[model samples]
Target chain A: MTRLRAAAALALAAPLALAACGGEDDGTVTLRYAFWDDPQRPALEAMIDAFGEDHPDIRIELEQTPWDEYWPGLDSQFAGEAAPDVFWNHVSRFPAYASSGVLLPLTDRIEESGLGTAAYPEDLYASWQFEGDQYGLPKDWDSIAMVYRIDALEAAGIDPSEIDDLEWNPVDGGTYVEFLQKLTVDANGENALSPDFDPENVVQYGAAMASSTGQTDWWNYAVQNGCELQNEPWGDYAVDAPECVEAIQFTADLYNRWGVAVPAEVTNQPNGSLASEQVTAGAAATALDGSWTLGVYRDGLEPGTWAVADNPSGPAGSGTVINGLSNAVYAGTEHPDEAWEFVEFLGSEQAQAIAADLGSVWPGVSSLNGRFADYWAGQGVDVSGFQTAAEGTTTEYPLSLDDAAFSTAALDEFNQVWLGDKDAQAAADAVVAIANE
Target chain B: MARLGTRYPSSTVNALNPVVDPARRTRRDRSTATAYALLAPSLVGFAVFLVLPIAAVFALSLFEWNLLTDPEFVGLRNYRDLAEDERALKSIGNTFYYVLLNIPIQTVLALLLALVLNSKIKGRNVFRVIYVLPWMAMPVALGVIWRWVFDPVNGGLNRFLDLFGVDGASWLNDTAWAMPVVASVNVWQYTGYTMLFFLAGLQAIPAELYEAADVDGASRTHRFFAITLPLLRPAMLFVLVTSVIGSFQVFDTIHVMTAGGPAGSTATLNYQIYLESFTQRSAGYGSMLAVVLFAVIAAITLLQVLLFRKRTVYDFS
Candidate 1:
């Protein structure tokens, strides 16, 4: 009995004993680096490989958490005081993390390191600032643009360039509706413009617009209408403003009131496909999608069949959501200095160029934008519309302290508006109220 | 045969060997010690994974912690908030809706499958494996596939319906159908697994009971009702208790499929807890919800035990 008990104790303690003796006896330091993007993993790995050539003693371990679980996992790790030394940060999530003392303030470090920050946009760099301290540095940027079928424009007898000038309003949807009407076809071969167009049996939808986040959907429209998602940066929840509601209603009008867009039932969560998925399947001829989904289109469909276009103009004219991510150092990290060097490396022109070469996203460095654009041009796809969309008026992502709370609240409430279960105004009011609370 | 005739099956051998002599007390003590040593690892694990967490959760429910911030005591504020929270009430209602939609159908279907597969038939083993494959598949992967299948416009379900000029209802988006659609995935995945338990129970029945029924000229239905059900009570208890517990905690399928939408219609307690704790970072309220969930599960399990305690036939012999 004693032997059996001893054996069991040894069995339990064996793993702990092995765990305690981790890492080689060499005088090498290991730093854990975390990121969420899977497609960019190769580029990040190559960057780390390059980083190792200069500093081989510092072994930077890369941990890739999938997008969905990244924040939740990070939150727990933060509570346990064991988050990675450095990790990627998003605009929506950045505010919450920055407000908390868990993030290492990088203002003094940025000055001490003397890394040039002029390459990144001023606003983009400033977005990572909480109070007076810089919690992160710019990593990459993305913008929303209309991804459409070139053939659909040809079939409708409309020039592909005509889509560039399409404008919208919350009241009538403007020329954009006329364009959508021409493209939206019924099973009887009738366009939405035709007298016999059957809304019941749509063979091809003009567009896909069931995005509840609105980053790739109504947020652009809202931005175009001069409606602010937040009253001011991280100040007040203001999507319930009349202009924002109007933009939301106009967005809904496409799915419900106009009958030109894909039915919300098939497009709304929780089982809804992405805007790119709908277009890839030929369900919808076009969708306002993020530049990150460039790969989804490039991989899912043929090269010449589809093309990207600047977003349709809203009341305030040419608007899209321009968002960027940043690399942040955990405050509690033992090797904060090494983690800062990694973050500094991430923001450098060289790293940005590497990311641009992969066409993963537009690099934060303004000079490297062409490389990102050139990479796709070589792929036989004109992705300049994404750049043009941002070149015009752009709306910064609505980030706030209660972003996590707002995300949960908005998902439930806006899903109702997308499904046509609740009024757009009511949903907007409810969400704004919840967010401000 | 006699091994099956005890309340505690593992204690049968020891029960047969009585430790009556006072001189054998030390040996009994040593044996008892050995038993405790054997159970010690599992007991420690149970304490760590289950009891400690429950206690921590209960304690945390009284405080406000947002993962990033320090936990501050809020006394019964979370509970009071939960009482007034319409969303919590609705989530509970939705959870029950999911449980009701899932459990009864899954249990009955499993029972039917068990009865069919328990018999001698062609490729029975193959059929058994085929039915259990869905159960074996990961819920998240199954959910993604099922989401595609249930897509109203381009899904396989609508395509199949289109063959007969019948339009399929929006399965996951329609509030009326979302809970049922999500529950159907769980039912489909678990019914086969539950069937295996019933199959074991069915096989464990002594052949003499059926023979006795045959001599009494009892009908197959009568024999099943009297001999099969009464004798299978232990299995029924096990299946029903575990199934009910599993059903109430359904999250993965719902998480991937409906995400507690098209208007928070499919959001169950577990999903809500996750959203509050993980997504919203409402750790305190989330912990409170978890405590409520634990209590509800415990209460239901207790009720099940009480209901099944007296009538269950532990030993057919």
Candidate 2:
């Protein structure tokens, strides 16, 4: 009788346990928004709070990942049909996502939200569009710029005005190289560029050529020199082209032939913090860093030491590579409407103004340029040159989701060139081989 | 039957029983057999986990699969690529160098520590525990601590060097020092574990022999060579074999310390396999490297066993 009673009890408890595990039907909608920028979290949170106040019926979840891990994580999530409703996208990575049908078309959303196409620059908007469908709404934009030590330039007896009229063409920019050489002084009484320059006793370098981030500055030169990274419609690798090789060689020569820049071995040292720690330690006079580095340099160096300038031109023309981040809805999102609504809110004038005010990024909308410039100027940074450089961009590469594999292969091949194991031409050819394969 | 028993011998009658006829057993008889029944669970486990997975890995190695897509068969291509791969070759060289660094240092240190503890020392157990503490710590945690200690800037090693006005070198970043630093950490962690084995081997050596050597006026070093070493040959062989295998398979420290960087200076074969499989999404190439590593390990282990078997003197009597 006791066993019978226990069996009946067990049978009853099974359904109760199952019921506890069952999914609930809450009337409130949940939206998942993913992004990679930790520095911009406060602004994003403020924007989301405003959106939440407007729509109390919706609940939003923020998924934050570091930029390196972001795309791969998103790719795996999309593959598993578990992607967030909205996520940050980049111009370089958008094409691969759009091609894979993972991004939701935002054409109708953009039209319906009353955010006219003209509000954002056409090229910026077109960068996020592919195959007649807009997959991403521009969130922010940026371009390459020269970051230099203002005091160092003045102390070296070189006028900063010399860089103002610096005409850059694809073929030759010897003047800019000379300027860098003149400004680079061995303040520690150790000559770094003279005939008696001690490689071991290098107290100061003239400039640092950025190499860790895929030789991005070199790519800008390549584009200016009439070398396309890929053929139109993004079909072929053009890194092996003579023009691209020249561009790559020119940047590599800054370290090798010119002796104006530090050795790649020293600058590329793993965990060495070469640029931030060593460069800001007053060891390097200049660095060809991204505009985003304004924040890093400001935090790293003493006040009134640095200023910004346009990148020198090559023989082809003066060029800058424009890149930006965008917000896109995941195609497999369960709450597509809610995701689109959030994306529209992100693109709104109010949100962009808030973003501009925070000085986090250059807001994508053209009308917000004044707000962004004023914000930076108020922070004691000269950002007027950045606006001009962004406007003068001649080429840009779409950051592909496959950049993890493609970039690793390319970087490994290029490391040989930096290490003096292979020439620039060979490195370029090797990169093409690896990328296409 | 009683009459037959009366007529036959007891031994003959016993032999005629059905239990004595082993060849005539049926399926049910075999199922009821004790030995086979006892081993059934272990046999099933071995078949399911070990044998089956090894077979599957062998099959997988012949295909080009990235886990995201269907695997396509491409026989010997992965192997061919492995031959030409400069990175894989460099890694192989690095792995051998690690083995060379680890085995001798670890074995000698372990033996030396065991000998010191075997003496008439107070608080011997306390010393043993202190020495073995590194082995007890989690490897990942140990790696993190070591990374800080070996850090080029603001590190313990650098600060220690600064006391003597010696400039601190980039221990983890400099290619020349990176592998040696990693090897030194491995030696530090494993010496105590190996020392335990040597201690056990030393304890088993009969005290009478050492007394005899002492009576002969043998020096401590001479006694160690004549009495202790010969008896500890088996322990030395065990240490060498295990240390060599462990060194070849080193991944964690290298992964944490370098991630095979500073121009691929410290990349080992195992690290390369990880990079190829996970980082590059080239599973086919990774599996090929894995197969090669397995073969190399197998060959080395077998060779060591054969070489050490002849050298080891196990008799204490």
Best by lDDT: 1
Off by over 4 Å in 2: A1-38, A48-87, A91-96, A100-118, A129-134, A166-173, A187-200, A231-233, A269-274, A328-344, A398-406, B1-63, B66-86, B117-219, B222-245, B291-313
Candidate 2 docking band? incorrect
Compute the lDDT of residue A413 as modeled in candidate 1: 79
Taking the candidates one at a time, how many backbone clashes does each contain? 0, 12
For residue B188, give model 1's deviation from the true position in Å. Answer: 1.5
How much of the true A–B contact set does each candidate keep?
0.63, 0.07
lDDT of 1 by residue, B241-292 (tens): 9999998898889888887787778889999999888888888899999999
lDDT string for model 1 (A248-365, tens) is 8888888888888888877774357667777888878889998887887888888888888888988887889999899999998988888888888888998888888988888899
What overall lDDT goes with each candidate model? 0.84, 0.73
The reply for model 1, stretches above 4 Å from the true place, is A1-28, A187-189, A210-212, A269-271, A380-384, B1-40, B313-317
Q: What is the interface RMSD of candidate 2, in Å?
A: 15.0
RMSD of each: 5.2, 9.9
**Residue-level lDDT tens digits of model 2 in A351-370:** 88888887777888889988
